[model samples]
Target: MLDFFSSNPIIALAVILAVGLAIGQIRFLGISLGAAAVLFVALGLATANPAIQIPPFVYQLGLAMFVYVIGLSAGPVFFKEFASRGWKLTLFIIALLISLVALAWVIIKALGLDSMIGAGMFAGSLSSTPGMAAIVQIVNGQDPSMVGEPVIGYSLAYPGAVLGTILVAAIGAQILKVDHLKDASEEGLITAPLVWKGVQLSPEITGKVGDLPRLSGQSIIATRIVDDPHSHRLADPQLPITPGMQLLINGTEEAVDKAIAALGEERETKIEDTELIYTRLTVSNPEVAGRTVGDLKTVEHGFMIARIRQGDTEVVPDRNTVINLSDRIRVVVAPGRVAEVRKFLGDSEKSLADVNLLPFAIGLSLGLLLGAIPIPLPGGTTMSLGFGGGPIVVGLILGALKRTGPITWQLPFHANRTISTLGLALFLAGVGTSAGAGFRGALTDPSSLIYMGTGFGITLISALVCAVFCMAVLKLKWDESMGVAAGVTTNPAIISYLNGQTGTDLPNRGYATVYPTAMVGKIIAAQLLFLLL
Candidate 1:
């Protein structure tokens, strides 16, 4: 077994990933380590046999693939968020991370530990494998022989980082006394869309369309209007309402109920034989990409976009809601305009699976170039974004751009996710195998336990402090605060646990809002910690 692994790097990596994933699926105390299992498994294999060596390119390739794809997937929201309320949340997270780095520095000085070891512990305690990679690069650039110390420190502190963050989030939930269900509902975390409601336009609903009471935090789209027994016209916000007229509306279930209460009693309106057709059309037209729903030439094409589905999330689109590539739009069109609508959308299922190789190649190549470029620092030294940070930063920029001229940057959602997952698995496998020998050496060292204990303390303190600040200072909700804490650590296990606990997507929203900035910040900070020391 040892000889086989030693001779074939690919086979060794495969074994690590397969076994790690299997171990990750096992729940202990209702929490599974998830993908982090790969790293521990790799460490075990490496320790068992020192000859099981892998090439450096394997790990670098995995890191680049993982971060680059993650950036692409998160780019749209990350950029959009800066213009909205997300900037404030991002700033707070940055501050928290800075504080954590300072705390690590103080601990390193007090303990009289080597700078490389300190940097590794900092990254490991956050469970940020990418950050650890950055530190390793810096250490190797300065002195190749010193590389082993950081990797050893990283392995020592990793388990604590994962468990510490999970414990903080779980404990924070209890301390905050969060009523998960109530908070989720109040925050509109439940995605309830595609509810068709029919109502009678009562006498009290006087005046024009502009006179209706506004349903705060709800988007209600009127689909059809029944003027009489035999005739009906497409509902428009501008169209005046009359007493005893039947109307069909589309929105969330709660919004529909509110609309019915505000308008009149519930009424049955059948549209089975109507010429107006309701259908789901995939957005494939390059011309419509990046344009808002209201901006689409739907009126000219004899169709009205009632709703749009982006990935699995259904959206009640507004005038400003942008149309993205492959969006499944629920359009209401006339019978004669079906062909025109289909032509405009380019709704081809085969096209969805077919990735535009040009843009994909261009994006990845550009990312590699950006990653290779170096920047000067104040201390007469230099640091690059490295393979980890460079690819992700470039991916974010391209992702936000969505499309430039003929090149559409967006990949199919499922395809993008698959690539990202594969990249991460390969990355962890590489890191684990690369650090295996060092991790084994550190395991027998008496002081290694002290280093790990200190790292755990740093992780716990930083997470607790940040969580409190998010709740008390930022006035964020409990789940949102916990999610931000989890994101700060960059641990997928914590994110999964929070999602299960809340039974809502509130934690996910919080996680996403802070992840990009936190990810980039930690990567850069880890290197800086190593260099400054």
Candidate 2:
């Protein structure tokens, strides 16, 4: 079995992924290792056999896909959060990185560990494959003979680092005695996503739907209005709300509840035979592109924009929410007015699926170009973004930029996720197999345990300290703090755990907000750690 796998890297990878993913699903105490399990599975296989190594290109491709997708997903929030609290978040991430590197430095120096080994440990402890890659890139340019040192240290430290992070997150949350669900609710994390609710208009309720208060920044769309006779019509915001009427309201739960308090009781009425038709129209009309949601004269056009489906997430667009090309928007309209609404939104599902691959190709090409460009350090050394940093940086920029004329730099939600998942899986398999031989040898060296322990300590301390600081000093909520901690480390498993606990995407938002900066910073820091040592 070992000999067969050792000779066939492709088969080895498939087996590794299959076993790893299956293992990842085995939840213990409500915690699953997720894709991080792949790395360990690969490591185990490689460790058992010295020759089970895949090509470097597979790993590079995987790393690029994972990082790029991450950046793209986080881009919108990344830019938004950066504009508000980017510096603070950035400083926090930088401080955490510095602390981890500093602690690792002290331990490595005390143990008389080699500089390359220390670099590997640093990258591994952070669970940053990009960081490891960056270190390797720097080392290759300076001293090719020392290339294996970082990988060895990284592989040895990797398992402990990932586990330590998970432990720190769980333990820290326990220590804080955090009621994640309640805390998330109070922090308005769960309410971030727009949801639909059916609201009835009472006798006391007066005025048109448009006249209702905006209700704490939540956008309210009355999709269908059921009159006293149970006849339903598309809700024109300007249309007066009669007494004993029912409304299919679209907004956040909090917003809907608030509206209910002011208007009428909550009703779960399904309106299928109504004159009001609900349909999702894909935006292909060039005139609608770049227009804000509020700018679209929906009421005048005999329809209401109920929800805007942008990629995987559905957004309840406020006045400021910009409409882009290929955005599948859910609009409420009369059957006769369907043609008018369709014309306005371009109503083509085919267009939504018709992805122009040029932007991705161009963006990646640019990213690779940027990564290859060398920058000189003070000591006459040089560094570059390499494959990992380049594509990610480009993806982030394009994602944040959202669009440039007809060329939108974005992938469909599912496509991005699939690509990213495949990329990370391939990367992890390659890294694990490559490091397997070294990891086994390191275990026999005695010093490997010390390196692992030190890396583990760094991971724990970094996560714990960062979490505490974010909560205590920055005044961030528990969910946000955990998210930041996980984000700074660039570990999706931690984010997933936190999100599970919180029952919200708050952790994900926090992770996305800091990920771009953290990724770039860590890449630079990894090289610096090696160079300085």
Q: What is the C-alpha local distance difference test score of each model?
A: 0.79, 0.77
Candidate 1 has an lDDT of 0.79
Q: Could you give candidate 2's per-residue lDDT for residues 171-228 as a string of tens digits?
A: 7678878787777777665555677777777787777776554532345767777663
**TM-score (C-alpha, index-matched) for candidate 2:** 0.84
Say which candidate scores most in TM-score: 1
lDDT of 2 at 500: 74
Q: What does the lDDT read for residue 524 in candidate 2?
A: 84
Clashing pairs in 2: 62-423
lDDT of 1 by residue, 1-533 (tens): 97799899889988888999899899987789777788788888888886776676777777887888788778878877778868987888777778888888888988898788778988998888889988877777878756657777888898898788788878777876789878877877877756887788777677644234353235777767766544556665555767776877778888888888878878777777776878888876667776766666466677777788888788777767878778899888787788988999879777767766677778877887887788899979888888888888988888877778777777767667777777777777776776777777788889898889988998888778777887788777888888887888877888888888888888887788888888888888888787777
- Colliding pairs, model 1: none
- Model 2 CA deviation exceeding 4 Å by range: 1-8, 142-146, 192-218, 222-249, 253-274, 280-302, 309-315, 322-329, 336-355
